[model samples]
Target: MAGTAGSGSSPLSAGGDGDDSLYPIAVLIDELRNEDVQLRLNSIKKLSTIALALGVERTRTELLPFLTDTIYDEDEVLLALAEQLGNFTGLVGGPDFAHCLLDSVRLLAVEACVSIAQLLSQDDVEVLVMPTLRQAAEDKSWRVRYMVADKFSELQKAVGPKITLNDLIPAFQNLLKDCEAEVRAAAAHKVKELCENLPSEDRETIIMNQILPYIKELVSDTNQHVKTALASVIMGLSTILGKENTIEHLLPLFLAQLKDECPEVRLNIISNLDCVNEVIGIRQLSQSLLPAIVELAEDAKWRVRLAIIEYMPLLAGQLGMEFFDEKLNSLCMAWLVDHVYAIREAATNNLMKLVQKFGTEWAQNTIVPKVLVMANDPNYLHRMTTLFCINALSEACGREITTKQMLPIVLKMAGDQVANVRFNVAKSLQKIGPLLDTDALQGEVKLVLQKLGQDEDMDVKYFAQEAISVLALA
Candidate 1:
């Protein structure tokens, strides 16, 4: 056989794409020995890939010593070298490496946690990670605290049943009070994750003991980012705590947020409560959050209302038909004719869910005729909204209404002037296709089908073909 190795070529270069084993590993390892900081940094990155790909023992013996020397290097390249080296060490040693690096990884874990948080992976979280992270949580640097939480996402998986709340809670409780808003937010999120994996019995205690007292401060956090993080943390708590606990402990805080001065904070708060009634099994939400949801339905800022609208169905479902009858009909009706096309679209989408729950008489007599008039509106988006409403209505109550009443408009829209509008029509048609008996409306329906099947836009054509198949029209 020919000689296995190439002469005078580094393994990485000679390995064909520089990845083969034949290349000289010694040459690259020597680059790490160079005094020039940039070259040393470059060698560090290449070595990290090798260490991760090769083995930790080799990396420990080789790559780790450089980190101690470069740990305080002010050059960004050297700082980066220190960071990846920590990640490599984190991966190899899991929690076990904490003793070896001592304050080196500890200091790095605290100082660069957020910026480098993403680098920590599941393998790094073994029993060793928590003790190290718990220590870093007390660092003077709040970023370390924040990064500790960001890295907590990995720990959520790695944390074993053997680990106790006592082991985890101390670190999170300490960080929750950190002066830095980002640190507090991150800490709140970690507590949320911790409760998620905890047995349900302990969830309430953890939230009460670890997460709740901080709520007022978090809600009132001057920083928008902190408020946002708290809002998410609150939602995470609800998932693990069960609906009843959510209602008693969390709902009030969420409700108060509806009136918050910051639109984003208000949006985050009320948005959580938007569909919460169903999740929590409480009719009070209909009585309480309904007004906020409806008010947000037509909010001046489109995004805020849109967030509320996305969750409207769950709220409506929780509230039930009687609730809409008593509280929501008027509000949804008012939004049906709102000036903004998106508001109208959202209003109509929610209204369609109502028709599904309530019955066709309510939709056909109360909602359909109004939507039909809007379907012919001059603004294309309004027309599209009208089409969206029709499709939703058909899915909800189309079986009850005569196809002649619904199909004429749907068929017309499948060939609308705008490509996107036509696409929506195709999607709506795809959904309703199974309910349609193609032979029933042969002439007019076939024309729409033909256009969709041959639509100039490839995406439109693809969906149209699917819609046709779903209808058995092909």
Candidate 2:
């Protein structure tokens, strides 16, 4: 009954004879009532084609009601409608078409909202679409509210600048403070893109008025995920707000984030330090950022400490040699004795990055001495850390230092009581051996390999034999 022709003459049948015969809108309309889903879908497809052929007036009079009737149908039917709805824009006009489609926004279906946001023109959006969006932005369903926040840009473009400033901004602000964390995150995530497109004066005005006030509350969001989303956008805000403004306003928020209870939020801030550095420069980072880095280096979560290790080179590169000599040097060395082996391993692995940055001369004078002290450390893990450092730094520190100074440490560790230390010694020798220049140094390496090859531990023996074969090939 829904798709049936009314008592009066059918407007759909008035098309050219050849077109009507080929499509037969009446038959397609009848097919819509068929129990078979595929048949109903085919009818919808054919109806879309007929709607296009019917021109604007006929499409409005004849086709739109049938499509609108199926608006509450199955998802596949709704998707098909959403796809074809844009085709009728010229016939019904943008505003009228948008209004017709959005009549069902409160139905809690995402397809209609997504389709309308994507398809409507700039003019239509300002008029009919913006009102629908503003209403949908506060839909009782959080998911429906998410759809509005997610598609804010598309809707923003529809309304254009004038309505965006007055109407859409208020809508976005409400969504930002939405009771749902997801809705709040969705709004926060779009803040950067919103500011990036505006003029400098407008960007400043929005930040000073709209953004800065909300930021402290956002950073302190009870949801860790919401805090993370805000963390990701801080640099963009800092860049837009400029150095002085960022320090005055944004930096306090960043400092507070470093003290957040969630390690992830703290980790997010550390990971984006380079972005922060881009705004505030190394001088500010040295003062504001260094203490946070030092605190995080000893974070209770090993994963958090591992993240700090991963970011060591970034901090070192930004802080420069003076900071490295004064602060980072001691911090990196302390990682050798970290309670977690994985943290120690990462610290050892990352040491070459520091060596490469500061150069071999500085390394030989500064880092190498400390590493040598760790090699003979009472704790076997520190010795293992030393072996890992030697393997990592071999090529970078070059043959002269690796063979003369570093090799003796490897040789001593080869006879270490711990199988882990001995295995790593074989591992370090394999990396360090090929860098040796003189026959005497090669012979000394071979002697250590021979001693390790006979070790009681099978893993050490396996690694030593493997090292022997690798060095022979070299």
Candidate 3:
């Protein structure tokens, strides 16, 4: 186990004498037999370094057999071998050697194939790796096919154009149509990157013709997670496919995804609407996309509504004034009174985003009146929503508008019988207090805060005390 096997002058001769050369080899061979798993793994890592140091001829003759023999070892040992085996690809004699190492471990372990694919060159990939990976694509183990699918880009880059079209395309088709949903999902995820890396001519002719159909099938994949993965990369496909082709070929698939049973698929499409809008154009999106978004804004699941609320500013920014005013404004107002406290809080907090995007005049003329009505609503939650909006909007709406117009509603809310309403009033004062210019307005804010500080609810009093401290610091 410890003997050196090479015939030519050893590369180790550059560093030291015979014993020094054999010492590392002896230690690694002995450690490989060590019962401790970690010791064996560490020995494998050191073996890679030694193989590189030994150069191609010595590694092929002296190191490869010991490395290859470990393929039948326990799972942990095989994983370690898989991770380190790539380091020897350059040191091996040729593709034949790389193939033997990879082919032996691949069926037994997934990481081995992945590492070999990543480490080998374009020529070796086509000659040696392709056959093994193609076999892996049809392997009963979904995980084995998943490893092949995950390495699709690395394999394609290795083989380049000629082999990719002839060999890899068929392999990819098989992977995309694999019986395992996970394998198909993994293959679908790489389709965008694969198309992007190819020349435009090839992307259109080979990828669009061969790969795009599989991608479209994945959008309707029975597995929700698979569809979600497809949703994540759909926008990238739109860019590669170009606008007309995206609309004609891919857009129907994208639009159909909006109705996907999976909330994540729907949410992902909404989140990426800006990117989709760029390719599809805002006006074009208005017909189908906007209605779908608006429908999701009122989705039965609050999480869906929450996602739309989170994305409201981007929607407003992208849709611009006319569209925001017509569609999104009412949605924001509805969220303000949403049955869920968290949704209402988020809608209230995002008020300033609308103000920031649309300007102070828009806030003064359009938004303030609606907020004033909410402040006086019979529902204490609506009144609480108003206080939160005032707190967030004061800085954006400026000192004059806040002190004159918004401060009175906050003052009224300070005396609200609902502790939550009064607590929000106290918090709102902290933001508005600093904006008061005149002594009269400043004293009014101070009086309201002091009243709240003495209120019965401890949470309300605590917030009032915090608000007073904030104003004092200002």
Report the number of the highest-lDDT candidate: 3
TM-score of each: 0.64, 0.84, 0.86
Model 3 C-alpha lDDT per residue in residues 318-361, reported as the tens digit of each score = 88988889877988988999999889988987788989999999
Question: Taking the tens digit of each residue's C-alpha lDDT, what string does model 1 give over 306-328?
Answer: 77766666656666666656766
Highest TM-score among the candidates is held by which one?
A: 3
Q: Give candidate 1's whole-model lDDT.
A: 0.62
Backbone clash numbers for all candidates listed: 4, 0, 1
Alpha carbon deviation, residue 223, candidate 3 (Å):
1.3
Minimum summed lDDT over a 10-residue window in model 1 is located at 1-10
In the range 386-440, model 2's lDDT, one tens digit per residue, is: 8888888888898888877888788877777889999988888788776886584
